[model samples]
Target: MEATELNIRISFGRKHALALLSAFFLCWHPGFIGSETLQLTTFYPAPYGGYVSLLTTGGTNTVPANTILARNAGRVGVGTGTPDSKVDIRIPVGLGANGVQITDDNANPDTRSYATLGVTRAASGNNLAYIGLTKQGTYPWAIGVAGSNDLIMGASSAGNRTIPSPMFSIDTGGQIAMGGGAEAGRRLRVVGDLRVTGDIYVNGRIQGLCQRIGYSITGVTSCPWNHNVIGFLGDGVARVSGFLPASATTSGVGRFIVLGEDWGGTMICCRF
Candidate 1:
């Protein structure tokens, strides 16, 4: 039951005032018990025009501390009912929001916006790779401080150094090595020539063959300019990828020579 307040100002004796007040209370709450009295504190209005209150039974009071003040305009304020941002947070999940954005607009140089995970192992676990980036499920780029990092495809070098070398690395030192499985020693060391098993898709021009020092492709395949054919035959297979005359292989997989007609003239070729 709601307790009603009466503005009674009596110019009578103190005992008379007490009697009148007690009588007034007894009339309102007939089962008036001992000691308990109505707590009459004025409910203050919130700074943003809403009523500040306590949530009783189901809640803390008429206005609870943890209560979220939201509006139909898709805005939510935490400490203050009036949120400045879309979902304004004064102190600090939600059923609905368009997209989540985390930003550090300070534009500082070395600020990390995303989460960072540092290596927690011992010195034996040194050179442990931290982050790896890839394309088509193959790791092509990586950033790790522990191990030797060398971009292995550009060249093959026999220079093998101690562990903890930079196999492929990128740092503020302005040092890069497109070398093989070892320390590049200096700033840049492209060990030797490159070899691949798949087709080389070149967006730009491909220069002539760069043979190894003191040697040439003529030592391997009679034709020095036969880099294309050399690459095709590097697998030790004699099978031609393009259409080859049946007569070419009909001689039963042994060294044989044959004649063929070409746009220029009749040509003779040897096959094995």
Candidate 2:
């Protein structure tokens, strides 16, 4: 039942006023009983327009508990009343709370679940978005999308650092750059010369079995310019006419010669 206020200026005794107020209450609630309860506070407006501090209870006739609160500056809070942001929420008491989750229960397979952050413009060397991980006493690490559209992962040099230097990055074209400040234009580009610990394979076949470092010479005593005789062989009856020196005296010099019978053999010449 709705209670109506009666503007009565009674020039009577306090007992008379109490009797008249009880009669007025009985008038609004016609079916009132001795054991029944009628909370009369609901029929009146709140004292203040908003709350100045956190509200723990709503008195005897109101709610027993409250989980939502609005600040005087129009900030709403959940699980707390002293909000800092526009909509602040904090876990009051929990051991392992996951905080919040944005979910969609639609039965469509191709439905996109989105949690988007949109920024109109970003400063140079800044991240458009980033996820950071930190330990108790270690430098924080982060992986982020740079302002230039490169995906970068870096560790903070200091504890209070905001922007992170890129250790390596993948550009918008799917090319990855290694080392600091390096750019890649090929499919796999490295900043330094490659060193292989194992055998290299090309087109699924092993490479670098043997390399042709020198040319074969048949029946030649002296090699060409910048070439030296590394190995020489003769026929059964032929021997070297002179002593074969390990070092050549002159450029394009050879110590091999035919001594006894007509003899000719190949000479392996190598150039450094």
Candidate 3:
């Protein structure tokens, strides 16, 4: 065995760590194979703990072909020369595939802080797309995808722990639910009152009770009934109190009815 002293070195400098490892210095070990194979391990100390890199760079004076580095950011990078984030991986074109997949099985349960895939924009811009599996604690999911235009579907982020006020909901049956907490078996449910800015076109029979208030009703007991707004289907006995048909008991059969005061001071009731 030829004797040599190779500095299996480390950096204890301020925060600037740059490893200067030569190829021949690595294969100088006695148990190493031929000159065609090269392997080396380098460790660096940083302000936030340290970093370890295991690299395989072929023969003398050769650059590293593959690297597995674990850095201060709790990140592991494979095939990456310089990592900037967590789980940073880079592979050149014409190599293998470049993608990430995470699945949970019996042995691997989904029990972690926050796991997010941020698809950032070009020129080191902000995130354009994101998908995340969030838990809790110091690592909360930060989604800057589409610059605040991210569309999220389904269950709560904290596994029903912290519930978000329902914006909209859709089930597998192709039924769309708008507004807040969905009804048990309803296709559409709005937590609060629904207001329509445009016209409503109904395919079939539109069953609902519509009434306008804030005006004085000449015939009814309460002049200018100002309570009933707009809804779908209700049962009530409407008594006409004032005009031509005063004290007329109008039977409301839980159907669409538009009742309001006319501009000419007339009580109009249109039932359909």
Model 2 misplacement above 4 A:
1-126, 157-163, 181-184, 192-198, 203-272
Q: After best superposition, candidate 2 residue 3: deviation in angstroms? A: 45
Of the pair 1 and 2, which is ahead by TM-score? 2
**Estimated TM-score for each candidate:** 0.20, 0.31, 0.27
Better model by TM-score, 2 or 3?
Answer: 2
Each candidate's root-mean-square deviation in Å? 20.5, 18.9, 17.9
In terms of lDDT, which candidate is strongest?
Answer: 2
Q: Which candidate is the best by TM-score?
A: 2
What is the per-residue lDDT of model 3 for residues 1-272, given as tens digits with 9 covering 90 to 100? 99998887865654343232444565467654543333443454545543344444342222333556665456766556467788776544432212332423323222443453322221112223333344433222423322223232322232212113334544454345565433456666556667799998878665444343232333343223433323222223353433433324654433444443242232323331
Candidate 2 lDDT, 45-135, residue by residue in tens: 5664443544343322332223566655768775554678988765433212123323244332123133211111222345654544544
CA lDDT scores, all candidates in order? 0.36, 0.50, 0.40
Error of 3 at 25 (Å): 20
Per-residue accuracy of model 1 over 1-272 as CA lDDT, tens digit each: 99999897758798988999999877785444423222222344644454333211112333322445555455665434465777654322121111122323323212323432222111222233233222232222323444333222221111111123335544344455554333333554456666679987878654443433222232333324333222221323233233444576475555444332211111122221
Question: Distance from true position, residue 92, model 1, in Å?
Answer: 24
The per-residue C-alpha lDDT of model 1 at residue 38 equals: 24
Poorest lDDT segment (10 consecutive residues) of candidate 3? 118-127
What is the clash tally of candidate 3? 8
